[model samples]
Target: MFFEILKNLRKKFKRLYITMFKNYIIFVFLMLLVLSGTIGFMIFSIGKMVSSEDYIKDTQKFFMASKIVKSDYKKIDASKIVASKGWVEILNSNKKVIYVIGTKKDKVTSYTENELLNFMDLSYNNLKSGTSYFYSVTAFNSNGEDLYCIVKVPPGIVTLNVDIAPSPDKYIKKAAIYILVGIFIIIVFLTVSVFLYAYLTTKKVVMPLKKILQGIKRMTEEDYSTRINFNAENKFGEIRDAFNFMAEKIEASIFERNRMENLKQQLLSDISHDLKTPLTSIMGYSKALNDGVVENDKKIKQYLNIIYNKSKRTVSLIENLHEFTKLDNSKFLISKEECDFCEFVREIVSEYYNEFEEKNFELEINLPEDEIIYEFDKVEMERAISNIISNILKYNEVGTKAKIELTYDNSKIQLIIADDGVGIDESLKENIFEPFVRGDKSRYTKGGTGLGLSIANKIVQKHGGTLTLEKCKKYKTVFRLKL
Candidate 1:
């Protein structure tokens, strides 16, 4: 048990209950060791005091002195008696001391019958003389006469006071039973103490565990907000922190999942509405032409052109939806290469320069002379930039000032496209880059699929860059692309 308890102490475990239990075991073991040592010491002391060799040898010496005094008192040596730190007195039947041997300190030479009996009694006390001695008396026959021989030993030499009885077996048996009962009571008391300590110590650990379990049960019931508070120490404190952190992460994950689900539903609804409007126009125009509803040749040509335009718009919407879906795919990879960003912007702007002139819109172009080379997919990057430029032309008035500026430093390149056009609605600014989110309320008349900004944002993200609609003091709408 000692080895097992010590071994557990040597290891470092994260569990609180195990550690507490080990400590309790160690405490009980130590208490038992101490109790056992105390009991053993008490038994050893009692046995040594009761039946020691010194006590037995002293009794034998007194018996030998009695025999020698009865047979031949002169042969009993006084030197031997004095050396043993005691004296001998030979008393006649009249209770009078007839002979004395060794160094005697007492002056009493005669004793009354009552005094003699008192001296021989087990509870003998020499209070009047202010000195105490142990007396052993032996009655024997000398020359056919009765004589009492008393051996007096000082208290410092040997002290034994035992009651004379016919049989001492019953007393011994009673003493043994009392000792056994005392030991049993002590063992029971110590056992109860150990268990109480174990329960109290383990209770501290169990309470915290119960609290954590309750939190887990609540979470399993879809209560993501459930949390636990444990104002404990060591492993329990750490467990509390870990559990709370896990709960926060789970709650956040659930919230994000719900948000993405809502966005998916909104995207589906917008797709359906945009597709149905263009298809309805195409179907109606074709039906009118096939049924000969228009008689004039000019009207027939106009109706055919309208049907053709509506079909083209429907096809464009489908193609934009396809591009958005492809870009949103997690497995999609962009082919990146080193390209001159300054020249790339200039070329894209030159393509739209004629359109700007035809629309009578003011244009501002700012491009650095030195080449700013960056890694990006040229085709994808062109599509993203063209989407922003096309949106500016589609929404702004004829006299709206359009600006394209490219700037760079040693670390990064920034391209800014700004226009003083009808600014985006405040309500839509936050979600402007979400799919199917449009600035124009009239979906049919806007001539846009509303996936332009979202696709552009995704493309820039794929190239490890950012495209953000930032606040600007000079322009109403500013799109900043950083690489």
Candidate 2:
């Protein structure tokens, strides 16, 4: 429920903001109109209510003058005072008669004369106190210098005359003029306010968003570096942060993917190198065996043996390369089962006893009876170790004893495979484990692809270990595996 309320409030605020965006002029106009109304009431209407009191002040003034007369005057003719002025009424304390008259612009106005007389008599009653009195009225200049007439104050209510043009109904016209003036002021303020507000809002909000849109357009066109770096607080800041995060992720993903593709290409190049050399040697040997131009059984048997070995070497290279490919592609999952490392290597070497006999290759096995247990993937480790053995078997010629040593020291397992037959050339020792790089040119065309060591190197690396031809000379090549 709270979330709903917040959602509603957000929608409402957005609508208000959009309304401000779209019809700001109209809104400003309406605001100015309200302000003008307040100002108008203050200026022309509000205080005036107390000022005129609807002609009541005039009536009260008249009554006060008549009362002063009654208190001060002795017996005298009341009609003479009324006759002294022409059309004006004397508001005098020493006057003989008390009377009231109405005038405008120094001349008596005849409109509503009867109502005027009734009011005059009512004012006199508040003053006269039942004294014998006949009221008189006269019109006067604005200075009260002329006398007008003597008549019964109650009876002569309608005798006055007025000359005038139509008064223009000033009250209604004044109201209309005030209204028009108010509308004019409101229009001026509204127009200016709306124009300024529209300019500022567009400059601050709409223009920045446009810039962000332009950046997006650039990005859509494959400009990866396009950035929306707006320095803002509210909604615009949020937009910038979101875009930045997305861009960062995109760049990282692209970099990693490109790196992987390059690595795959490099792997293919290595495979070609290993396969081409072996197949070339195999072809030369197979042609020799097939031609059978040998003069003796001995040379022919040698040719056939070379062909068989070359074929085996090519097959082993391809298999090992495929295994490495699987590992590199994350298709293989290794298991962590404990095994006696010394026993494992010893037993594996023992399995190839017949091949050793046929090739007259002596195996020098050095191990301890104390079981060296280690955690590894069994089948994969076997392939890795066996590939190294295969490399030794292919490179070392007849009667060459291959040294196999396994030792554990200081909480680490180490395996050493060394061959004393034309080991590896000193200059090429460093690159011996690189894919398809055969170190000893003298040992070239012996019968094995060079990728064997590379696969072994990669597998050992995968096991959090290192395999290196640590040292090599003309007669000794030593490979050390530390796990």
Highest lDDT: give the candidate number: 1
Question: How many steric overlaps does candidate 2 have?
Answer: 13
Q: Indicate the worst ten consecutive residues by lDDT in candidate 2.
A: 157-166
Report the lDDT tens digits of candidate 2 across residue range 1-483. 323533644664486577655666676566867786757774666246335554333223222333223322232234432442322244332332233433212333232446335444553335343433334343332234332222333223212221112232444565566667766776787688768877877775787678767866776776767677766775556666766666666667778788668756876886777677768987887776678767688887887787777677778778767776777665556776898888898888888778777889777778888999999877878878888877777767889877788999988998988877766777777767766567677545564556677778777877889987765452377888999
After superposition, which runs of candidate 2 have C-alpha atoms over 4 Å from their true positions?
1-270, 273-315, 357-363, 442-444, 472-475
- Candidate 2 overall Cα lDDT vs. reference? 0.62
Clashing pairs in 1: none
Predict model 1's lDDT versus the native.
0.78
Tens digits of lDDT, candidate 1, 383-427: 999999999999888889889999998778898999888889889
Model 1 regions lying over 4 Å from their true place: 1-210, 229-238
